[model samples]
Target chain A: MPEFTLWDIVRNLLLAARWTVALSFIAFLGGTVFGLLLLLMRLSGRRVLERLVGIYVQLFQGTPLLMQLFLLYFGLAVMGVNTSAWLAACVALTLYASAYLTEIWRGAVAAIPRGQWEASASLALSFGQQFRHIILPQALRIAVAPTVGFLVQVVKGTALASVIGFVELTKAGGMIANVTYEPMLTYACVAAMYFVLCFPISLYARALERKLA
Target chain B: MPLQLDFMSILVQWPLLLRGAAWTIALTAIATLLGGMLGIVCAWARAGGPRALRWLVGGYVEIIRNTPFIVQLFFIFFGLPELGIRLSPMTASILAMTVNLGAYATEILRAGIEATPRGQIEAAESLALTKAQVFTRVVLPPALKKVWPALVSQIVIVMLGSAVCGQISTEELSYATNLIQSRNFRAFETYIVGTLSYLGLAILVRNLLYWAGPRFLFGR
Candidate 1:
């Protein structure tokens, strides 16, 4: 057996980090689209549609993401669909992100003053025109900090994708530790990488929130 | 092959699921108590303590908050053993959970503490109350009351995170579900049961914390 060097471990982790970054982007982007649709349906003045979206959010938020991954992974298999960990992880994470992002965006929209909606209505603009031109821009300002902060959460959440056998950073660290018998170094590197990935966004969010306030 | 779902098969292993849920609750309870106390102390340190202590607490909060909880758990459970500080899975889970919650709760409590009016602290100081008395009697209760909802949500997040504790073989609900699935080849059903239990637990814990936050921690 060959000896494993520190650089080799770092290189392998860097390679795996690509998948982590990719998965995070997939989940975040997909979630934003879905979350926006849910936000619209929620604001559309249809009580049943609003309640349906509420249940969707509650279902996702009320359970562990781990279980969500498991359900998609095994649930897909049981339904006679061929499932890779990647597919299952992506689907599960997209739904999870949708749930959270919708709620966060909804809160931001709700923060807007009531007068603006009334003003838009009086201007004879359709609901879509009012929302598109007047509402989303303002809500987007409030939503930016929190949504970026939530991206950090989504990145961290992709670590759960590892449990289903997607070889992301955390899983790769575990694999490396198994081979090198150096879990301390491997996991320390893993934590540092995550910190590097998350801390700047966390800081930016804080700064933006402060500026906004 | 036709798909046949059997919920009854997984339901038969209720004992394991119950035990797993119990461990999860126990882990959360212990972590909540210890981590909540740590949060208070750290919040106090950061808010009113010396400069060095404040920086120290701030660093601790940032480091823990930025990293994922699962990695932290793995580090404590898997990494610590290499340093000659071996801990049982249960001990490591509790330690990891407490440290994780402590970091988050510190920030939450700090926000609350910072919101405390300057006048109130000054008034307490003018009363000749000791610093400790001023914090505990004058500062903490109202701060806690103000942030109880946020703190409760954090605790619930921590509780849901306990699902990962089973990765270390601590036999939490997810672990029990995994074991039953392996035994009976009812993976989907087992997970469904586990997920529902977690959902129930989350709701139950949130209600419990909301109810207890005022009655026990602060006056209603």
Candidate 2:
């Protein structure tokens, strides 16, 4: 057995946190792409497309993320796809993040005045051109703060992935606690590391929101 | 070779699954009640508390909201014994959930409280009611009634978040599923059963929250 000191625990946690950061970026970035697609699908003129996307958001939003991770982990392996805990965790989180992001961006886009869209259309702009030139830039401004706010959520959510056996910060904390037999100290350090990672983001989100307001 | 999935083996552990589900519900309910009360106090602090108190509440909410629930759970459960306070996994899980949920509840309730008009407080004052009376009888009800929707949503989030308590060996739904999987090697079916059970619990809590909304709150 290895002797664990405060520095030892923090050092190990920092290393594990790299995975948390990597996974958060993967989920957030990948989810943003899917979210954008879902947003367009939701805004499309076709009823069935819109309805399908609407239900997708509801299914992910209404269910627990932990459950989503389990379903993806087990579901993928059951379907005969090669499944590792990491891949399942990433895919499930991306899907979950996408569902929520789609709704958030959709709301942001809808809040843009209708007259602006009509103006862009009258300028003989194609739908893509109109959205690109006129709408998204403005909507992105309003979206920035909330998007960042949602990022804080994404970071918090990554902790849940530990349940799937990914050795991220929370899991590593657990591992260290088991070895050091200092559950409380090991875990408190874990919580502090998370605070260090997330608290600034929360404050920044609030500042952005205030500026936007 | 094709994957050999076994539902029968998983179903053979149905009693175990039910026990897990029962523990999850029990944890969720206990955490919510305690958390909800803590939230009300924090919320009240934010609304009318002293400047120092407001800063304390603000800091608490920001810290909790920013961090992950798993880390918070570990802090309270695995982290507390270092301070010489030992608690069972069940006790630790509920306490963690309550603390985590309270921060969120405070944020939600603070929003509700802030939205209450200053005019209403003045009206209560003109009636010469004591501050406690004004808060209980006049102000808090309307504030909470207006924000019940957001508050209920937070409660649901807390309910789902309780699943993390499995990490500490509380043998809640997820822990039980993990046990069954390792024991019987029925990974897919066992996990599927677990996910469905969680989804069911989430829905049931939402329904219960909705039903209790008008009865204990706003009906006076």
Instruction: Tell how far residue A15 is off in model 1, in angstroms.
Output: 0.9
**Model 2 ranges with Cα > 4 A deviation:** A1-4, A118-124, B1-15
- Residues A1-213 of candidate 2 have per-residue lDDT tens digits of 666678998899999999989999999999999999998888767899999998888777766788788888888977888999899989998998999899988888999999999999999998889888899999999888988888888888999889889989988989988888988777778878888888888789889999998
lDDT string, candidate 1, B78-156, tens digits: 9999989999999999999999999999999999999999999999999999989999999999999999999999999
What tens-digit string does per-residue lDDT give for candidate 1 at A90-164?
A: 999999999999999999999999999999999999999999999999999999999999999999999999999
Error of 1 at A103 (Å): 0.2
- The most accurate candidate by lDDT is 1
- Which candidate number maximizes DockQ? 1
Q: In candidate 1, how many Å is residue B115 off?
A: 1.1
TM-score of each candidate structure, all chains considered together: 0.98, 0.92
Ten-residue stretch with the least lDDT total in model 1 chain A: A204-213
